[model samples]
Target: MTDRASIIAVLSALAIAAGGAALGTAGQVPQPAGDAPIIIAQATGAQATGPSAANTFNRLMKRPGSEPNIQPSKDGIHDPANPGTALLQWPSEAFAGFPRTNDGNRVDWVKTLAAGLIRPWTELEDPEAEPFLMDLTIVRQVKGSMPNVVYPHLEHTQWLDCTNCHDEIFVPEKGANQISMAGILLGQKCGICHGRVAFPISDCRRCHSQPKTAEELRQLSEKSSWAKQ
Candidate 1:
Protein backbone atom coordinates (compact mmCIF):
# COMPACT_ATOMS: atom_id res chain seq x y z
CA MET A 1 0.00 0.00 0.00
CA THR A 2 2.98 2.46 0.62
CA ASP A 3 4.51 1.73 -2.88
CA ARG A 4 1.05 2.26 -4.47
CA ALA A 5 0.77 5.74 -2.80
CA SER A 6 4.27 6.74 -3.99
CA ILE A 7 3.40 5.84 -7.65
CA ILE A 8 0.15 7.86 -7.47
CA ALA A 9 2.01 10.99 -6.08
CA VAL A 10 4.61 10.80 -8.93
CA LEU A 11 1.84 10.56 -11.61
CA SER A 12 -0.01 13.60 -10.13
CA ALA A 13 3.23 15.73 -10.11
CA LEU A 14 3.93 14.76 -13.78
CA ALA A 15 0.39 15.74 -14.84
CA ILE A 16 0.83 19.22 -13.16
CA ALA A 17 4.19 19.76 -14.93
CA ALA A 18 2.68 18.79 -18.37
CA GLY A 19 -0.25 21.28 -17.82
CA GLY A 20 2.30 24.12 -16.97
CA ALA A 21 4.29 23.41 -20.20
CA ALA A 22 1.05 23.52 -22.30
CA LEU A 23 0.08 26.86 -20.70
CA GLY A 24 3.58 28.28 -21.47
CA THR A 25 3.36 27.19 -25.19
CA ALA A 26 -0.14 28.82 -25.45
CA GLY A 27 1.32 32.26 -24.25
CA GLN A 28 -0.42 32.00 -20.89
CA VAL A 29 2.85 32.00 -18.82
CA PRO A 30 3.39 35.14 -16.69
CA GLN A 31 6.76 36.93 -16.97
CA PRO A 32 8.88 37.63 -13.88
CA ALA A 33 9.29 41.24 -12.59
CA GLY A 34 11.76 43.54 -14.56
CA ASP A 35 11.81 41.10 -17.54
CA ALA A 36 11.11 42.75 -20.98
CA PRO A 37 9.22 40.93 -23.75
CA ILE A 38 11.28 40.50 -26.99
CA ILE A 39 8.96 41.44 -29.91
CA ILE A 40 10.61 41.24 -33.36
CA ALA A 41 8.63 43.25 -35.96
CA GLN A 42 7.98 41.33 -39.21
CA ALA A 43 7.79 44.49 -41.40
CA THR A 44 11.11 46.09 -40.24
CA GLY A 45 12.91 42.91 -39.10
CA ALA A 46 14.00 44.81 -35.98
CA GLN A 47 13.10 44.94 -32.29
CA ALA A 48 10.10 47.28 -31.83
CA THR A 49 11.34 48.52 -28.47
CA GLY A 50 13.53 51.12 -26.62
CA PRO A 51 16.56 53.07 -27.95
CA SER A 52 19.55 50.97 -29.19
CA ALA A 53 23.11 51.46 -27.83
CA ALA A 54 24.31 53.00 -31.14
CA ASN A 55 21.43 55.52 -31.24
CA THR A 56 22.12 56.50 -27.61
CA PHE A 57 25.82 57.04 -28.41
CA ASN A 58 25.02 59.20 -31.50
CA ARG A 59 22.65 61.41 -29.48
CA LEU A 60 25.33 61.96 -26.81
CA MET A 61 28.23 62.63 -29.25
CA LYS A 62 26.65 64.63 -32.13
CA ARG A 63 25.45 68.22 -31.57
CA PRO A 64 22.01 69.63 -32.58
CA GLY A 65 23.07 70.65 -36.17
CA SER A 66 22.96 69.27 -39.71
CA GLU A 67 26.75 69.72 -40.31
CA PRO A 68 29.44 68.64 -37.85
CA ASN A 69 31.47 71.40 -36.14
CA ILE A 70 35.20 70.62 -35.72
CA GLN A 71 37.32 72.92 -33.48
CA PRO A 72 40.99 73.52 -34.33
CA SER A 73 42.28 73.21 -30.75
CA LYS A 74 41.23 72.76 -27.11
CA ASP A 75 41.63 76.46 -26.22
CA GLY A 76 39.67 77.52 -29.34
CA ILE A 77 36.07 78.78 -29.05
CA HIS A 78 33.04 76.77 -30.16
CA ASP A 79 31.70 77.37 -33.71
CA PRO A 80 28.72 79.70 -34.15
CA ALA A 81 26.79 77.18 -36.34
CA ASN A 82 26.98 74.53 -33.60
CA PRO A 83 27.45 76.07 -30.15
CA GLY A 84 28.99 73.00 -28.48
CA THR A 85 31.25 72.05 -31.43
CA ALA A 86 34.88 73.26 -31.39
CA LEU A 87 36.93 73.93 -34.57
CA LEU A 88 40.62 74.51 -35.28
CA GLN A 89 42.41 76.69 -37.91
CA TRP A 90 45.35 75.53 -39.99
CA PRO A 91 48.88 76.82 -39.07
CA SER A 92 49.09 78.84 -42.30
CA GLU A 93 45.64 80.38 -41.77
CA ALA A 94 46.37 81.17 -38.10
CA PHE A 95 49.62 83.01 -38.89
CA ALA A 96 48.50 84.71 -42.13
CA GLY A 97 49.44 88.13 -40.73
CA PHE A 98 53.16 87.26 -40.67
CA PRO A 99 55.61 88.32 -43.45
CA ARG A 100 55.78 86.42 -46.76
CA THR A 101 58.17 86.38 -49.75
CA ASN A 102 57.76 88.56 -52.87
CA ASP A 103 56.19 85.58 -54.70
CA GLY A 104 53.57 85.34 -51.87
CA ASN A 105 55.27 82.25 -50.44
CA ARG A 106 55.60 81.68 -46.68
CA VAL A 107 59.08 82.75 -45.39
CA ASP A 108 60.89 80.38 -43.08
CA TRP A 109 61.55 82.82 -40.25
CA VAL A 110 63.59 80.31 -38.24
CA LYS A 111 66.04 79.65 -41.11
CA THR A 112 66.14 83.35 -42.08
CA LEU A 113 66.87 84.51 -38.51
CA ALA A 114 69.49 81.78 -38.03
CA ALA A 115 71.23 82.87 -41.25
CA GLY A 116 71.64 86.42 -39.91
CA LEU A 117 72.42 85.65 -36.23
CA ILE A 118 74.92 82.80 -36.72
CA ARG A 119 78.67 83.61 -36.55
CA PRO A 120 80.71 83.74 -39.79
CA TRP A 121 83.36 81.08 -40.62
CA THR A 122 86.15 83.73 -40.79
CA GLU A 123 85.44 85.05 -37.24
CA LEU A 124 85.98 81.62 -35.57
CA GLU A 125 89.61 81.12 -34.41
CA ASP A 126 89.50 77.28 -34.33
CA PRO A 127 89.32 75.42 -37.67
CA GLU A 128 86.69 73.08 -36.12
CA ALA A 129 84.79 76.01 -34.51
CA GLU A 130 82.76 76.38 -37.69
CA PRO A 131 81.80 73.32 -39.76
CA PHE A 132 83.92 72.48 -42.86
CA LEU A 133 82.11 74.83 -45.26
CA MET A 134 81.78 75.10 -49.06
CA ASP A 135 78.97 76.14 -51.43
CA LEU A 136 78.16 73.83 -54.40
CA THR A 137 76.43 75.12 -57.54
CA ILE A 138 74.56 72.43 -59.48
CA VAL A 139 74.45 73.31 -63.24
CA ARG A 140 73.52 69.93 -64.75
CA GLN A 141 70.45 71.02 -66.70
CA VAL A 142 69.08 69.21 -69.75
CA LYS A 143 67.77 72.53 -71.04
CA GLY A 144 69.11 76.03 -70.40
CA SER A 145 65.72 77.18 -69.00
CA MET A 146 66.16 77.16 -65.18
CA PRO A 147 68.99 78.58 -63.04
CA ASN A 148 71.71 76.63 -61.23
CA VAL A 149 70.97 75.26 -57.72
CA VAL A 150 73.23 76.89 -55.10
CA TYR A 151 73.66 74.35 -52.26
CA PRO A 152 74.82 76.05 -49.01
CA HIS A 153 77.09 73.54 -47.22
CA LEU A 154 77.69 75.78 -44.18
CA GLU A 155 73.96 76.02 -43.33
CA HIS A 156 73.47 72.24 -43.66
CA THR A 157 76.69 71.33 -41.73
CA GLN A 158 75.56 73.55 -38.83
CA TRP A 159 72.57 71.29 -38.23
CA LEU A 160 74.08 67.96 -39.42
CA ASP A 161 77.50 66.24 -39.21
CA CYS A 162 79.60 65.32 -42.30
CA THR A 163 78.75 61.60 -41.99
CA ASN A 164 75.02 62.37 -42.33
CA CYS A 165 75.43 62.75 -46.12
CA HIS A 166 79.10 62.53 -47.14
CA ASP A 167 80.12 59.13 -48.74
CA GLU A 168 76.72 57.50 -48.01
CA ILE A 169 74.21 59.67 -49.91
CA PHE A 170 76.62 61.71 -52.07
CA VAL A 171 80.21 61.10 -53.28
CA PRO A 172 82.67 63.57 -51.65
CA GLU A 173 84.44 64.22 -54.97
CA LYS A 174 82.93 66.79 -57.37
CA GLY A 175 81.23 65.50 -60.57
CA ALA A 176 81.37 61.90 -59.21
CA ASN A 177 77.55 61.57 -59.26
CA GLN A 178 74.91 62.98 -61.57
CA ILE A 179 71.82 64.52 -59.83
CA SER A 180 68.71 65.26 -61.85
CA MET A 181 65.15 66.54 -61.15
CA ALA A 182 63.81 63.12 -62.16
CA GLY A 183 66.09 61.38 -59.62
CA ILE A 184 65.27 63.96 -56.90
CA LEU A 185 61.52 63.40 -57.40
CA LEU A 186 62.15 59.66 -57.06
CA GLY A 187 63.81 60.30 -53.61
CA GLN A 188 67.47 60.09 -54.75
CA LYS A 189 70.36 62.45 -53.95
CA CYS A 190 68.88 65.80 -52.70
CA GLY A 191 65.39 64.22 -52.51
CA ILE A 192 66.57 62.20 -49.47
CA CYS A 193 66.61 65.35 -47.31
CA HIS A 194 64.57 67.92 -49.27
CA GLY A 195 60.76 67.41 -49.19
CA ARG A 196 61.26 65.09 -46.16
CA VAL A 197 62.80 67.10 -43.25
CA ALA A 198 64.44 70.04 -45.06
CA PHE A 199 62.55 72.78 -46.92
CA PRO A 200 60.37 71.64 -49.82
CA ILE A 201 61.52 71.64 -53.48
CA SER A 202 58.60 73.88 -54.49
CA ASP A 203 60.69 77.04 -53.84
CA CYS A 204 62.71 76.75 -57.08
CA ARG A 205 64.43 80.13 -56.75
CA ARG A 206 65.75 79.30 -53.25
CA CYS A 207 68.35 76.93 -54.77
CA HIS A 208 68.35 78.09 -58.41
CA SER A 209 69.57 81.64 -57.66
CA GLN A 210 71.84 82.09 -60.71
CA PRO A 211 69.75 81.93 -63.91
CA LYS A 212 72.32 81.16 -66.67
CA THR A 213 72.06 82.63 -70.16
CA ALA A 214 72.41 80.41 -73.29
CA GLU A 215 76.11 81.36 -73.50
CA GLU A 216 76.68 80.34 -69.86
CA LEU A 217 75.05 76.96 -70.48
CA ARG A 218 77.47 76.29 -73.40
CA GLN A 219 80.46 77.29 -71.25
CA LEU A 220 79.18 75.02 -68.39
CA SER A 221 78.84 72.07 -70.81
CA GLU A 222 82.43 72.65 -72.11
CA LYS A 223 83.75 72.80 -68.53
CA SER A 224 81.87 69.58 -67.63
CA SER A 225 83.40 67.75 -70.66
CA TRP A 226 86.92 68.91 -69.71
CA ALA A 227 86.42 67.75 -66.08
CA LYS A 228 85.29 64.28 -67.31
CA GLN A 229 88.45 63.94 -69.47
Candidate 2:
Protein backbone atom coordinates (compact mmCIF):
# COMPACT_ATOMS: atom_id res chain seq x y z
CA MET A 1 0.00 0.00 0.00
CA THR A 2 1.06 3.61 -0.50
CA ASP A 3 2.36 5.53 2.51
CA ARG A 4 -0.86 7.49 2.80
CA ALA A 5 -2.92 4.33 2.63
CA SER A 6 -0.73 2.80 5.27
CA ILE A 7 -1.17 5.83 7.45
CA ILE A 8 -4.90 5.70 7.00
CA ALA A 9 -4.99 2.03 7.86
CA VAL A 10 -2.97 2.50 11.01
CA LEU A 11 -5.07 5.43 12.04
CA SER A 12 -8.23 3.41 11.49
CA ALA A 13 -6.83 0.61 13.60
CA LEU A 14 -6.00 2.97 16.44
CA ALA A 15 -9.52 4.36 16.44
CA ILE A 16 -11.06 0.90 16.55
CA ALA A 17 -8.76 0.04 19.40
CA ALA A 18 -9.43 3.15 21.42
CA GLY A 19 -13.18 3.24 20.84
CA GLY A 20 -13.48 -0.47 21.37
CA ALA A 21 -11.57 -0.32 24.62
CA ALA A 22 -13.77 2.44 25.90
CA LEU A 23 -16.95 0.68 24.84
CA GLY A 24 -16.12 -2.96 25.46
CA THR A 25 -15.36 -2.68 29.12
CA ALA A 26 -16.18 -0.37 31.94
CA GLY A 27 -16.21 3.31 30.99
CA GLN A 28 -12.60 4.28 31.70
CA VAL A 29 -9.86 3.77 29.19
CA PRO A 30 -6.46 5.11 30.19
CA GLN A 31 -5.78 8.46 28.51
CA PRO A 32 -2.68 9.18 26.42
CA ALA A 33 -0.86 11.88 28.35
CA GLY A 34 -4.02 13.99 28.05
CA ASP A 35 -4.22 13.22 24.32
CA ALA A 36 -4.33 9.62 23.16
CA PRO A 37 -1.69 8.45 20.67
CA ILE A 38 -3.81 8.09 17.56
CA ILE A 39 -1.84 7.81 14.30
CA ILE A 40 -2.56 11.50 13.58
CA ALA A 41 -0.53 12.41 16.63
CA GLN A 42 2.05 9.93 15.45
CA ALA A 43 2.55 12.27 12.48
CA THR A 44 3.46 15.22 14.74
CA GLY A 45 2.90 17.11 17.96
CA ALA A 46 1.58 20.35 16.44
CA GLN A 47 -1.90 19.54 17.78
CA ALA A 48 -0.64 20.59 21.17
CA THR A 49 -0.49 24.15 19.91
CA GLY A 50 -4.13 24.41 18.78
CA PRO A 51 -7.51 24.22 20.53
CA SER A 52 -7.21 21.45 23.08
CA ALA A 53 -10.83 21.59 24.11
CA ALA A 54 -13.92 20.32 22.25
CA ASN A 55 -17.36 21.96 22.36
CA THR A 56 -20.89 20.80 21.64
CA PHE A 57 -23.01 23.29 19.67
CA ASN A 58 -25.51 25.10 21.83
CA ARG A 59 -29.04 25.71 20.47
CA LEU A 60 -29.65 28.84 22.50
CA MET A 61 -26.99 30.65 20.50
CA LYS A 62 -28.29 29.45 17.17
CA ARG A 63 -28.93 32.00 14.46
CA PRO A 64 -32.60 32.34 13.62
CA GLY A 65 -33.96 30.09 10.83
CA SER A 66 -31.05 27.63 11.10
CA GLU A 67 -31.53 23.95 10.33
CA PRO A 68 -31.86 22.13 13.66
CA ASN A 69 -31.03 18.47 13.25
CA ILE A 70 -29.51 15.62 11.31
CA GLN A 71 -31.61 13.78 8.67
CA PRO A 72 -32.40 17.31 7.55
CA SER A 73 -34.69 15.89 4.96
CA LYS A 74 -36.75 14.51 7.78
CA ASP A 75 -36.84 17.77 9.71
CA GLY A 76 -37.75 19.72 6.57
CA ILE A 77 -34.37 21.44 6.60
CA HIS A 78 -33.75 23.07 3.25
CA ASP A 79 -30.30 23.67 1.80
CA PRO A 80 -27.65 23.48 4.47
CA ALA A 81 -25.40 24.49 1.55
CA ASN A 82 -25.63 28.05 2.76
CA PRO A 83 -23.74 29.21 5.87
CA GLY A 84 -26.71 30.82 7.62
CA THR A 85 -28.22 28.44 10.22
CA ALA A 86 -26.25 25.44 9.08
CA LEU A 87 -23.14 26.46 10.97
CA LEU A 88 -24.90 27.11 14.25
CA GLN A 89 -26.75 23.82 14.62
CA TRP A 90 -25.59 20.37 15.75
CA PRO A 91 -25.33 17.90 12.85
CA SER A 92 -27.01 14.95 14.56
CA GLU A 93 -30.74 15.43 15.20
CA ALA A 94 -31.40 15.33 11.50
CA PHE A 95 -30.00 11.84 11.08
CA ALA A 96 -32.35 9.15 9.75
CA GLY A 97 -32.44 7.00 12.83
CA PHE A 98 -31.33 9.62 15.35
CA PRO A 99 -34.78 10.56 16.71
CA ARG A 100 -37.52 12.78 15.49
CA THR A 101 -37.80 16.33 16.83
CA ASN A 102 -40.83 17.42 18.78
CA ASP A 103 -41.86 19.00 15.49
CA GLY A 104 -42.23 15.39 14.30
CA ASN A 105 -39.48 15.41 11.63
CA ARG A 106 -36.35 15.42 13.82
CA VAL A 107 -34.64 12.86 15.96
CA ASP A 108 -33.52 12.99 19.56
CA TRP A 109 -29.73 13.24 19.18
CA VAL A 110 -26.70 12.80 21.38
CA LYS A 111 -27.47 15.84 23.50
CA THR A 112 -31.09 14.86 23.78
CA LEU A 113 -30.12 11.30 24.43
CA ALA A 114 -27.72 12.50 27.10
CA ALA A 115 -30.15 15.00 28.52
CA GLY A 116 -32.19 11.85 29.07
CA LEU A 117 -33.55 9.64 26.32
CA ILE A 118 -33.23 5.88 26.62
CA ARG A 119 -33.31 4.26 23.24
CA PRO A 120 -31.11 1.27 22.43
CA TRP A 121 -28.87 1.03 19.40
CA THR A 122 -30.17 -0.62 16.25
CA GLU A 123 -26.92 -2.51 15.77
CA LEU A 124 -25.34 -4.50 18.62
CA GLU A 125 -28.27 -3.70 20.78
CA ASP A 126 -30.83 -4.68 18.18
CA PRO A 127 -30.46 -7.08 15.27
CA GLU A 128 -32.86 -5.11 13.12
CA ALA A 129 -30.24 -2.66 11.88
CA GLU A 130 -26.59 -2.11 11.00
CA PRO A 131 -23.69 -1.93 13.42
CA PHE A 132 -24.25 1.74 14.09
CA LEU A 133 -27.47 3.71 14.39
CA MET A 134 -26.24 6.71 12.40
CA ASP A 135 -24.55 6.35 9.05
CA LEU A 136 -21.40 8.24 7.98
CA THR A 137 -23.37 10.51 5.68
CA ILE A 138 -25.76 11.41 8.47
CA VAL A 139 -23.44 11.37 11.47
CA ARG A 140 -20.64 13.38 9.87
CA GLN A 141 -21.57 17.11 9.84
CA VAL A 142 -18.36 18.47 8.34
CA LYS A 143 -18.51 21.81 6.53
CA GLY A 144 -16.75 22.45 3.25
CA SER A 145 -15.56 26.02 3.89
CA MET A 146 -13.68 25.39 7.08
CA PRO A 147 -9.88 25.04 6.98
CA ASN A 148 -10.02 22.07 9.31
CA VAL A 149 -10.86 18.45 8.54
CA VAL A 150 -14.06 16.71 9.59
CA TYR A 151 -13.49 16.36 13.31
CA PRO A 152 -11.47 13.22 14.03
CA HIS A 153 -14.60 11.69 15.49
CA LEU A 154 -14.10 8.13 14.25
CA GLU A 155 -10.53 8.24 15.48
CA HIS A 156 -11.39 9.71 18.86
CA THR A 157 -14.24 7.25 19.23
CA GLN A 158 -11.51 4.62 19.46
CA TRP A 159 -10.28 5.80 22.82
CA LEU A 160 -13.42 7.44 24.06
CA ASP A 161 -16.47 5.40 24.95
CA CYS A 162 -19.63 6.15 22.95
CA THR A 163 -21.23 7.71 26.00
CA ASN A 164 -18.24 10.01 26.37
CA CYS A 165 -18.56 11.32 22.85
CA HIS A 166 -22.17 10.86 21.85
CA ASP A 167 -24.92 12.44 23.92
CA GLU A 168 -22.33 14.81 25.42
CA ILE A 169 -19.52 15.94 23.12
CA PHE A 170 -22.19 16.79 20.55
CA VAL A 171 -25.82 16.16 19.81
CA PRO A 172 -26.71 14.27 16.65
CA GLU A 173 -28.59 17.33 15.52
CA LYS A 174 -27.68 20.97 15.15
CA GLY A 175 -28.03 23.59 17.94
CA ALA A 176 -29.00 21.02 20.55
CA ASN A 177 -25.46 19.97 21.49
CA GLN A 178 -24.26 23.45 22.36
CA ILE A 179 -20.68 23.04 21.04
CA SER A 180 -18.82 26.26 20.54
CA MET A 181 -15.08 26.79 20.04
CA ALA A 182 -15.14 29.33 22.84
CA GLY A 183 -16.84 26.88 25.18
CA ILE A 184 -14.66 24.00 24.05
CA LEU A 185 -11.50 26.02 24.74
CA LEU A 186 -13.01 26.33 28.19
CA GLY A 187 -13.64 22.56 28.49
CA GLN A 188 -17.18 21.77 27.25
CA LYS A 189 -18.66 19.55 24.53
CA CYS A 190 -15.84 17.89 22.60
CA GLY A 191 -13.46 19.45 25.11
CA ILE A 192 -15.32 17.87 27.97
CA CYS A 193 -14.26 14.44 26.75
CA HIS A 194 -11.19 15.11 24.60
CA GLY A 195 -9.26 17.67 26.67
CA ARG A 196 -8.45 15.15 29.37
CA VAL A 197 -9.46 11.75 27.96
CA ALA A 198 -8.92 11.55 24.24
CA PHE A 199 -6.09 13.37 22.50
CA PRO A 200 -6.04 17.01 23.50
CA ILE A 201 -6.45 19.57 20.71
CA SER A 202 -3.34 21.30 22.05
CA ASP A 203 -1.78 19.76 18.94
CA CYS A 204 -2.93 21.68 15.86
CA ARG A 205 -2.40 18.58 13.77
CA ARG A 206 -4.79 16.44 15.72
CA CYS A 207 -8.05 17.95 14.38
CA HIS A 208 -6.86 20.48 11.82
CA SER A 209 -3.94 18.17 11.11
CA GLN A 210 -3.81 16.92 7.53
CA PRO A 211 -2.83 13.89 5.53
CA LYS A 212 0.40 14.08 3.51
CA THR A 213 -1.23 13.91 0.09
CA ALA A 214 -3.43 15.93 -2.19
CA GLU A 215 -5.61 12.90 -2.81
CA GLU A 216 -6.32 12.49 0.90
CA LEU A 217 -7.14 16.15 1.17
CA ARG A 218 -9.58 15.94 -1.71
CA GLN A 219 -11.09 12.76 -0.34
CA LEU A 220 -11.67 14.48 3.00
CA SER A 221 -13.19 17.39 1.13
CA GLU A 222 -15.91 15.15 -0.30
CA LYS A 223 -16.86 14.01 3.17
CA SER A 224 -19.05 16.01 5.60
CA SER A 225 -17.74 19.49 6.46
CA TRP A 226 -18.51 22.96 7.92
CA ALA A 227 -15.58 24.90 6.40
CA LYS A 228 -17.26 25.49 3.04
CA GLN A 229 -17.90 29.17 3.54
Q: Highest lDDT: which candidate?
A: 1
Estimate the TM-score for candidate 2.
Answer: 0.28
lDDT of 2 at 147: 43
The residue-by-residue lDDT of candidate 1 on 28-65, one tens digit each, is 33432333433232132335486553343332232222
Which regions of candidate 2 are displaced past 4 Å? 1-146, 209-229
- lDDT of every model, 2 decimals: 0.56, 0.47
- In candidate 1, residue 28 scores what lDDT? 35
Looking at model 2, residue 143 earns an lDDT score of 43
**Backbone steric clashes in candidate 1, count:** 7
Query: Looking at model 2, which ten-residue stretch has the lowest summed lDDT?
Result: 36-45
Give TM-scores for every candidate, taking all chains together and pairing residue i with residue i.
0.42, 0.28
Cα deviation of 27, candidate 1, in Å = 47
